[model samples]
Target: MTSIAAVTLEVADVAAAERFYSAAFGLGSQVRLRASEAATTGFRGFSLSLTVANPATVDSFAASALAAGATSLKPVTKSFWGYGGTVQAPDGTIWKLATSEKKDTGAATREIGEIVLLLGVDDVKASKKFYVEQGLTVGKSFGGKYVEFATAGPSPVKLALYKRPALAKDVGVPVDGSGSHRLVLTGTDAPFTDPDGFTWESASSLTPAP
Candidate 1:
């Protein structure tokens, strides 16, 4: 299985945007230039690699993306949690950027690891059965319509299921199935939402405990 590492975002200008992030979120000064013109920047634990593109290229991509139905939003500003940004793709896909310093070391260093996806299912029973057949051990039921599933492998990932309506109430959101939810578990794990709509979380501490 192809496990996820870090989600990369296409930014306007590497240095300017990076500076903005650093000042806005107090990010670290560490920045690395890849073989390409792109630069990889790091914060405390997570990293943001700004791939530089020519001005013309950026304009062209933006135009093409907007033409294809993409809507771009300003990056995430100061929030109760941290700093981040957002963008809507041509296919109505949404992307977010945030500065996370937490690292996933273990139980001693962190609690939950990797990304946690809250999925809304039309049929909880059917979805639960499908995941169970796939080898995932379903954990305790949160309530009547919510449950937790844990899988052990190279990287531990958690899949939390909630009734669409129930999840909305828990998160205090209107509950749009198409919305994106990004989460950082523990300290080092970088779990993110995949383009295919399946939430993916990766973590070293996610393995089962003895």
Candidate 2:
């Protein structure tokens, strides 16, 4: 079973990024990587998604993120698929807070039920194939539109892929840029890049050679 052990984001100010993410998403501040000022620019080609139990939870999470310094990209709305919204974190990383279906829980919920890292790929099919070759099991796939992989572990963050334009539209951003996506995925295997240039690093391969 392949599990995503860690996801690293390159940030101009690691300390500030840490604070924003922690306060906004309830994520800890220990998972950030400091990058040189010259390395921070443009879209990172991905978005982090948090899936809660219901619509009220989604709204609450979105509001919390905004209060924590996130810029609203898309206001919360109910669509055929579900209820959700998009926000850009202080470090320029896009985030989507959503729920797949409406529930009558009738109470405000604040806990995040799941997390996902959605990659914007130039070619969805090709990128999906590359990840499959890397030993990830496919969960749900929508041909060239979207694909989700199943991960087995404590972290609930799943890996997914969507076309660049479609992803940009979902996150309310433009689909062109050049800069480190500022993302790092760690697994229990060798490091590799997908067809779309997204890097997956090995959890056990972080040691520097002597």
**CA lDDT, every prediction?**
0.38, 0.79
Q: Model 2: how far is 65 from its true place, Å?
A: 1.3
For each candidate, what TM-score against the reference? 0.35, 0.89
Model 1: per-residue lDDT, tens digit, 1-210? 222222223343445544443432222322211112332221111112111122232233334334444455543344554433444442222323333422222222111224334455666776677555544577657544877776445433345666667644433334444323222232134444332334434545344321
Number of backbone-clashing residue pairs for each candidate, in the order shown: 9, 0
Model 1 lDDT vs. the true structure? 0.38
- Report the number of the highest-lDDT candidate: 2
Candidate 2 residue lDDT tens string, 1-210:
276777777777887877787777777522445564646455678998988888888888788889989899999999888889999988788989988875546565677777889999888898888788777889999988899999776644788998888888889987877867778777757788777777778778554211
Candidate 1 stretches greater than 4 Å from native: 1-114, 142-144, 177-210
Instruction: Report the poorest 10 consecutive residues by lDDT, candidate 2.
Output: 29-38
Give candidate 2's TM-score.
Answer: 0.89
